[model samples]
Target: MAVQENLLLGAKASKNATLTLVFLSILKGVVGFYSGSASLIADAIHTSLDIFTSLAVWIGLKLSMRGSEEKFPYGYYKADNLVSLFVSIIILFSGVELVREALLNIASPVEIKLQGIALGTAVFSVIAMYALSQYKFKVGKQIDSQALIADALHSYTDVFSSLIVAITIIGSLLGVLWLDSAGVLVISLMIFKLGIGMAKDSILTLMDAWLDKDSIERIRQNVGSIQGVKTVDEIRLRKSGLVVFGEIEIEIEGDASLKRVEMLFEEIEKTVKNEVKNLEHLVVNVKPEKISVMKIAVPVLMQEGLHSKVSRHFSKAPYFIFIELENNDIISWDVSENPAAGLEKKKGLKAAEFLKDQGVNVLIAGEIGEAPFHTLRDNFVKLLQMPEEIEDVEQVVKKVSELNTLTAPTE
Candidate 1:
């Protein structure tokens, strides 16, 4: 959904929660006042605080939807987390107050007025807050709203505290007043722990915690799969409320034209958007990849142009040298009539030296001797074999292109 619509839905949910809490607090307050039960009054106050926190959540969600301005270029996405942290602080204070009140009552031993109405009211509060917490939690998870989640947790603590109040009332009725105080203490500590955890999570988000490893690996795989992308050099992702912001650097072939590079970048962006979820903002930077150029030399016995017939002899007396380049285009052609081509002593070495000196990175020939093979291998030249039946220069080039073992020279 759009940000505005999502925020509107969150506001509606928070408003409904606020109204429910207000009504429940009023009912509990009326019962506590009639019975003069201090525990019941404390629970009522907790519910009223939840109402305020719910309102804070509504305000935060609404404010988070605001667009960026000159003063705040990144928008108000962090407002949601800030409000959540604020609610956690409120919860923490409430826990402390409850603990202090429970300890003082335990120490002084005030007789709690335990009545059927008080117990019934406590039960009702527990059930109501439990239902409200469920609703809030479900909606918060659906929209991925952190403030709503914090508010939901705050409401959840209310349900537990109400349960403790019920126990306190039951213990007072059974003349075991200390159990009520003990339950309150336990409930307060639980709330304190939950509040601290929620606050820590909010602070981490506000500080821009790094994304998980799985997400980084997924980005690398998706971007690396794009055509012309050599590698995904770097990936950085950070969470902002429900959205994710990312920066990536990818490498492509250096010889690509500006138009081709632009198209590749577009493809990378589209692919990432399609594969990743909740990516609100993405910055992709492209770098050119370095690659080594291959220069292939083929000995040809021809009577015509570049596509002429191939020669089967490696140390032939007179041969036409066809140099192939990266795109299978010929760079040059020369008639190599080396006198060492007819020599028996070190003829293969001499021919290999001649080809190497011509700056040939790869040699395509038919039936090269062992001596020339070692020479080519030592000189870091790749060799592909051509059969005698392959008469055309094009056929020799095709054979070399199809060769899989470019690391080792072939006879």
Candidate 2:
């Protein structure tokens, strides 16, 4: 779904939650006021505060949808985090207020009038708030709305608060007047814990903390496996309010043309976004691989050290020598027999795949068929030919080193 639509849905969900809290608060307040139950009154007040927090969520979701990229390049994603912090503060203060009222009542020893209505009202509020909190949590996580989640946490605390009211009312019925006062204290501590946790999460999100390690590693593996990506240099991502923002630096395919590079960039972006959830914006940097030491492959008819004669048929070659040269100096050489020599069909394709796996950048062959020519060229393997007089592998290396655009291959 579009971000605007998602935000609109979030706003709708929060609005509904706010309306529900208003009703629940009213129900609890009327019951607590007549019964003189301080615990019930405190639960009612917490529900009232949830109403305001839910309104904050609605406003924050609306603000997050307003895009001002020209004025604020990062947009208004932080609006949700700000709302989360605000809701947490309200919750914290509510907890403190509840605790104060509870301790004061304990010191003065106020009498609580127990009735069937008080217990029934608290039980009803508990069920209602539980259902509402679950709804908010599901929607919040579905859309990844921080403000909505914070509000959901706030509402969830209401379930516990109402349960405390039920317990206190039962204690009052059992002739323990002081039990109602102590119940509110437990409710206060639970609310305090939840508020602190929520506040810490909101602050970290506002600070643009680094994304989880698993996500980073997933992006690295995905981008690295692309056909045109040589290396994944760096991946940096951080969670904004509802989305993730990041940049990835990668080395482009070997000797890729401009058009090819563009395709690689698109592939990398598509792959990373598909792999990572909520990744809305990504910057891809494609750098060309610097050619320092390049490996060249030569087809030979014999296993002789460096004097193996060039094979007329590429796929039928008995041995292939891989020569690594840096700045035109032979650094190392290894010879391996061509395993595709026995393939009667698709021999050229098999040989090309083998050389490609062997890290051959350029193929020095005497005669290359049409199939292998396109296959090798598509893989960024340079196709070059030796003169008719060059029959040995040593001469082949010398000719390849001096070969340039002047003596390029011809069909």
- Separate clash counts for every candidate: 0, 0
Model 2 regions more than 4 Å off: 294-411
Point to the candidate with the largest lDDT. Answer: 2
Model 2 pairs whose backbones collide: none
- Estimated TM-score for each candidate: 0.67, 0.71
- Lowest summed-lDDT stretch of 10 residues in model 1? 402-411
lDDT scores in order:
0.78, 0.84
Name the lDDT of candidate 1.
Answer: 0.78
- Per-residue lDDT of 314 in model 1: 76
Instruction: Tally clashing residue pairs in candidate 1.
Output: 0
User: Per-residue lDDT of 102-183 in model 2, one digit per residue for the tens?
Assistant: 9899876566654799999999999999999999999898888888988887888889888988988888888888888898
Evaluate model 1: give its TM-score: 0.67
